[model samples]
Target chain A: MQFTSEQRLDDGVLEREFTLDGIPGVLWTPGSGSAPAPLILIGLPPLGLRKVYARVAARARYYAAEHGFAAATIELPGSGERPRWEAAEQARADLRRVMAAGEPVTDEIVDALVLPLVERAVPECQAALDALLSLPGIGGPVGYEGGVISIGVRLAAVEPRIAAAGLFAGSFVPAAIVEEARRVTVPLQVLLQWDDEANDRQAALNLFDAFGSAEKTLHANMGGHTGVPRFELEAGARFFARHLR
Target chain B: MQFTSEQRLDDGVLEREFTLDGIPGVLWTPGSGSAPAPLILIGLPPLGLRKVYARVAARARYYAAEHGFAAATIELPGSGERPRWEAAEQARADLRRVMAAGEPVTDEIVDALVLPLVERAVPECQAALDALLSLPGIGGPVGYEGGVISIGVRLAAVEPRIAAAGLFAGSFVPAAIVEEARRVTVPLQVLLQWDDEANDRQAALNLFDAFGSAEKTLHANMGGHTGVPRFELEAGARFFARHLR
Candidate 1:
């Protein structure tokens, strides 16, 4: 990991920008120089880091300033400054066409849109995890927080370092990912927007049901897609505090 | 309300056994002289107070000692040492018969089992609230937690003092009560036992969906009936703290 830029946030969190294997990412650590603090990997949707930077930074800062946990996130393969691939671009176009016509998003379209991203993103996150944990102050017993639900599911399923996951069930999940969720045994806290227009409620519920974790919890709040209440941020912090700490 | 017994728990929570009109109840308050603390009405299942005293006391004490909130509960009309009615007995028999025969618990049976209790219990709980809140140390902006969900839905709908409710969706819900849930606009945190043997999962999900509160949240945990994790008590206290405080 190579440091590119650095700034100290107002809340006393140390925000550092870095790149690992050509993938750009940011990391936040508590200001108090708490050595060996638990790490939380902030998963990003394909929306790119710059677009969601403010919201994502707020969450990372909350974890660092309020809970003394380190948090990091990397750009997805086909997003932001990363070079776009034909398959990913084609999938996005297909998704838009189906939605514009008000036709149902078929499983085929969903699989095409999400599967490849999951295939590539999970390893990048794991690689980022390897790099983040190797830093001077950040420590093990990591957590994964909201981004794309399928990527979170796949990472939590395969990554032993992820002691807990706080997932946002606000995206389209492929059927294969739903089945893969059964392999995840870490403690899980899933956030679901009850009236989310962009997501299928039953599919989210089914994914929650499919989790193999003995200590999984579903926190379904009443809202549209982007309307998760602010209090849930604290609730998610407490969930992580219980497991990651 | 007449005090029958008073005891200070080890953690300095004051537990008082009281009788209001002919109904027996218990109240717990923080040990220190903090007047007018927020109150939580502990809704009890039809099981007699004596039968669930240890568990009930633990919850009440948790609220009083941990959150400095006054907590109270009263025996249902046909429960504990109270007089029993033939209809309630018949409903109990019907419920047992259906369960033993592996038959579905129809809405008819659910109404028979719960509606009368709700009718009688809501008024009794309201009266308890009236008497409990009238006391010097207990205050308003009350929260209702657990017990029969239909009674909770009814009370939350009709009672103005209840600012929030933490409902356990473990009991059979009547169709009318499901409709009544739409009238409850208070912030709600509902608890669902995912694999509960006696509770219908779909019905619980539907009841959660039917609630009209704009800020409602559902916390579904992986457990059988009676297997709610101990940590949720603290979570419920935090929920009450958010609204009641």
Candidate 2:
């Protein structure tokens, strides 16, 4: 399937749109250069619609513009410009339909659906990655970033493409998956919500053990799972720039 | 500051510790070979003496283990096992102190703090970018993955990071300081409760817009800011795997 590209601006930043292998997506090209740059693919929560992800995409574009990099955000196969799922059940049913269509429920489907929907929308997350990789300047290798603020930590384990990742207010996947993900050959940055309710310190400890690497940094910020302290962004941005850049 | 390192295991994985300069920051290691891997730094939200961020750190470790990557989750300066904040107000004060102490707040700080906090936390969100320069295994340039999801499009202009991040739930900080935080160029991610009484999707959009590279991921798991979802662990695991790995 052929995809098209369009240009638009949110808050005075330039953004473009396109489809990837039939998936509707958007590209936020930093008017900088055309070299293959780092790409960040965002995952949506189960109840979240394409609009929410679009905000994230727009944010990515802004970041790219400022950082001299190219950025793109894509909607799921059946999301964004695609059909909508009115409720949890409807979303699940739609997922099932996608699976039934012989779509090869890869990591994207699992992230966008099963994990977040059933577990926390981890499985279906790959949809975003797939879309991001399909872009003109994005298909080489990729960096990974996310946090429990959206899905959780476990889903990150399943993605094999992430060379370096930064997680905020994040948690670990099941022990098995945690162990599996730890086997990935990438640099990782994790951000935790010190007062988070969903996952506690003990759980975070368990996750750390599962990772088993020495090149890791741990930072604590203020806020609950829903209330991370304000200072975290500075630390996170520094960390991302230092590592990912 | 001299940093130290130690190792431990939680759920059947190896975890490491890094002392900020030399304190009690913990790190999780993924992978087995005796090779130097890239480093990743994880950030956690603060709630003082709470184990919230700790759990997130552990999850990062688990992701490292599964992905065979070397990683770490660190505590913020004066957080976790280090000098701790006396209260949220104190924490905020500490932030100001850090800003003041740091090499004068430059355009970066202005981009990270002053702008987003003041202008948008309540309304209108700006677009940002998500770019990955590295990842595990897929060693190459990174690219875009998928479509965008714009939740609370109206709130796209609001800078939820430093201002009224969880404002919808009646969680408000001094609007003035929030405005100050808007200028900071710190990367932030805001998690909004779908069912929170104070949730204003429009405000969230504004928050997104103002926060620079902010991204919002919505979940319909049914709960308040402090409540855990039915599949919290399962979902969290998947989230980490997909994005972090």
Candidate 3:
């Protein structure tokens, strides 16, 4: 999963691509840094392409460059430029293909689809984790953080290698899954929004309680389920710096 | 003010009454500790009835007793069983009279008239604060914490005797007011919820950047509009215990 710092595109956005355990991913990496730094993976749920994710990805690239970290915003399987759903069954089968290929898909999908279909995709998520870990400079100890949903957090938590993990505006999975996720020993940060419609305050509270870590930090900010505002970035950055290292 | 343990109700479902500076209020304390606590001030905006206030008050009482803190649920001037309003202007007059009298009215009156007339009853809010601080154990160092809507926090902050103050989920106030509030040197904890609709997260961030106190601790939670969720009580309790004392 070695992400190369390549030149900006015609639109003046930096771009790069890499292959993780044979799964190729195009990365938008900022070029201002030379050292190997922390990497961020951008994922969107099964919804249509959202420009917000791109904007956030761009901001992440900027932050990574400014702070001297290697950042990669990748389009997940069946997302962004690779949308492959026409019928529901086709989408499920497509996801199964990705899972069979050993890409990392979150349990959210596994729980949503039939057992046979999920069984096929389980290895994909593992492979994705492997691909993510295989990226140059991403090895050793790594931290994963996300806010769109609980998918990313769940994915990161199951991987024993993620040293630290954080979730902002995350939804809660089934109680059993949450219980399993709580077993993750890494330092965990859960950020919740008060007025979020998709995942309301109660969901956040339940997730926080489920974590069962006395050291787990629960931050309540003013955003919906999207992302954090810019000014608040410093606090989040400080938290990440303080704990991730 | 010194709040005696006797003044505190039992953990199970219960009801009690209080007269703060002659303002009478019935506290409804619930038995189960599952519900989230509400800071039910009877005389605040969105006026309702005495029974409503009483129920909310009881809930607050129960919440405080169960959670080991105090709950202040008040009654407005004209909403509940106290009286009825002939018109908006009459309601205004009634509010003035209530504030001037400094007597506790039923939750009905407080909700219907008192809260709606807050801006005109600025002096009343101040007087209430004074009376509140005059209570047995409330004396020493009064601090305020709030978000974008900071009338309550501002009142608490400007008081010279307040030991410390913090604002979370807050919006920008007038410079003079902020300057005056900043003069109070106490440990401050500002929790900003980024991406809020009413008060932009960037604005809160900038305010935090310009605010006073080297002891200031800024945190970003994932929420909007309404303040942090109840689960944050863990952080809030720890913070207030450390600073308010």
Task: Tell me the whole-model lDDT of each prediction, alpha carbons only.
Answer: 0.92, 0.43, 0.49
Q: CA lDDT of B128 in candidate 2?
A: 15
Model 2 DockQ (Cα-based): 0.02
The candidate maximizing TM-score is: 1
lDDT of 1 by residue, B42-95 (tens): 999889999989998999998888889999999988898999889999999998
Residue pairs with colliding backbones in model 1 are none
Model 1 C-alpha lDDT per residue in residues A216-244, reported as the tens digit of each score: 99999987999999999999999999998
Give the range of the ten consecutive residues with the poorest summed lDDT in model 3 chain B.
B37-46
Question: How close to the true structure is residue B189 of candidate 3, measured as C-alpha lDDT?
Answer: 62
Winner by lDDT: 1
TM per candidate: 0.98, 0.39, 0.45
- Alpha-carbon lDDT of model 1: 0.92
Each prediction's DockQ against the real complex? 0.91, 0.02, 0.07
For candidate 2, the share of real interface contacts preserved is 0.00
Descending-DockQ candidate ranking? 1, 3, 2
Candidate 2 chain A — worst ten consecutive residues by lDDT sum? A147-156
Shares of reference contacts reproduced by the candidates, in order, are: 0.97, 0.00, 0.10
Cα lDDT tens digits for candidate 3, B148-215: 23444344445454445446545434444445445434566676654356565654555554545545
**Second chain TM-score per prediction?**
0.97, 0.45, 0.54
